[model samples]
Target: MTGKSEHDDSEREFDYRWARDAPHKEPSARARMLAARWKENPPEPVPFRGEPEASGPRRSSWISTALVLGCVAAIILLLGYTRFQAPY
Candidate 1:
């Protein structure tokens, strides 16, 4: 029973060979309208400054270095006091 139905479907199926020779048409109406609007009012490019400030002797990391050294010194002091001094 299924085989007969399959044969009938195969006979009624659409042929796709003609699509290869069909001529292509221009863009759809909606696409043309959108393109025209974009062409008439395109978006502006974002403003950008020249070469970003060079890393020349103009920048300093002394503050960051001092903070790190301070943290290390505090940790070392706490450890030494805990080991050598009597607990309160």
Candidate 2:
């Protein structure tokens, strides 16, 4: 599955250029209508920040638990190895 017997040089180039340089223009009447509507009913409020303390404690608890588990696993592995070591 390949070129102009299918789709080759000129067609492929045309498609690429069409996507890159397509014009986007709203008609003048539509633009004026939008401006008039916005002049009366403005946009709604948007809060950008979250509750810092709410997330902070949870993140710290997760890190602490992960560290504890990792230490416990390492200790278990060390004990297992010691139990099987050949005495010299």
Best-performing candidate as measured by TM-score: 1
lDDT for model 1 comes to: 0.83
Best by lDDT: 1
Off by over 4 Å in 2: 1-14, 25-43, 52-66, 69-84
**Candidate 2 residues 25-44, lDDT tens each?**
45589888988998999776
| Residue 85 local lDDT, model 2 | 100
What TM-score does candidate 1 get on C-alpha atoms?
A: 0.34
lDDT for each residue of candidate 1 in 1-88, tens digit (9 for 90 to 100):
9999999999888767765566875788999998999899986685676657667664359877888999999999999988888766
User: What's the TM-score of each model vs. the native?
Assistant: 0.34, 0.32
Misplaced by over 4 Å in model 1 are 1-40, 47-59, 86-88
> Model 1, 19: alpha-carbon shift in Å?
19
* CA lDDT scores, all candidates in order: 0.83, 0.76
